[model samples]
Target: MELISSDKRNQLFERFAHDAFHLELRDDYSVPNEVGPFEDWLNGRESDDSFMAPWLQLMKRVTESGKTVRRVRVVTEPHSPYIQWEHATTNVNEEAGELIRWLPRHKLPAGLHFPVDGNDWWLFDDKLLAVGHFDDGGRVLGSEIIDAPEIVAECIRVRDLLWSIATPTNEYQL
Candidate 1:
């Protein structure tokens, strides 16, 4: 297994955002301040009322431009109303809800996909495969970057299966 440093993983994401399909799955959408930089970025904005404005704007542009940005949230402990509130305040929940409403969950066929247990993220771009590991502090430790076809195929399969079972943001009747 080849190991990739954190910096490399960030670069990969930067490039992947522009070049490849992206999917992210998290155990819970909400995280503590010390766990990720997203909350800090949101709180550090110049205006309190416009918190998450930039994120919302970007999401709007992405959706308007006709691109797919799929995300899955696995319900677990430590659920935070703050996170949901933020999404609602920014209109992100509404936007995501609308997008999901158009897509029938039953149309998603069974297949393999990646599994996100919170600390690791597996990515597949064509024939390349990367498995990133993070420290308890939420810093990427290293990644096993491989070009093996079998490994990439397996990761793809895992990703598909997970996607199939994920609850659609809009179609979630419960």
Candidate 2:
């Protein structure tokens, strides 16, 4: 299957109407842009979050236009360092208009199964999906675009189920 570059995948955000939802299933993410910030946090230094400016801006623009952007992060009970950092910074995301929730992996509904081979995905308007792909080391390798009705349907089902049970970031404790 062909995968589109992250830039191309982000372009979908512009075309999608109504809403966009992201399902995050990883304990840690090794995004290159986040390397420095993550390290700084680990070392007890003040980490700069300028890297997120663009994404924050995009989210602001989208939500201001009446579109909703949301995400459900399913994580292990003992959060990874990256996840801890993500949690601390989530308020900025919310301030920018994104709705983020956290779900402890153990709390997931019984018998819940992930679609698209258990990969992370972004569902746009309940119609399109940009499924994230990663390299051996967990760095992102772009995303595969899938719009098949059956697949999109399954993702939508999972999204609704997970969203219902996940705790909103503000209320979720470390």
Report the alpha-carbon TM-score of model 2 versus the true structure: 0.98
Return the top candidate by TM-score: 2
> Per model, how many backbone clashes are there?
12, 0
**Residue-wise C-alpha lDDT for candidate 1, range 1-174, written one tens digit per residue:** 467774575455434442223344333333343233455445663324344454455555655555444444433234344433333343353463223221223334455233433333445355565565655555545776766777666656655665667655555432
In order, the Cα lDDT scores of the candidates are: 0.46, 0.94
lDDT of 2 at 160: 97
- Residue 40, model 1: lDDT of 44
TM-score of each: 0.49, 0.98
All models, RMSD in angstroms:
7.0, 0.7
| Model 1: per-residue Cα lDDT at residue 42 | 54
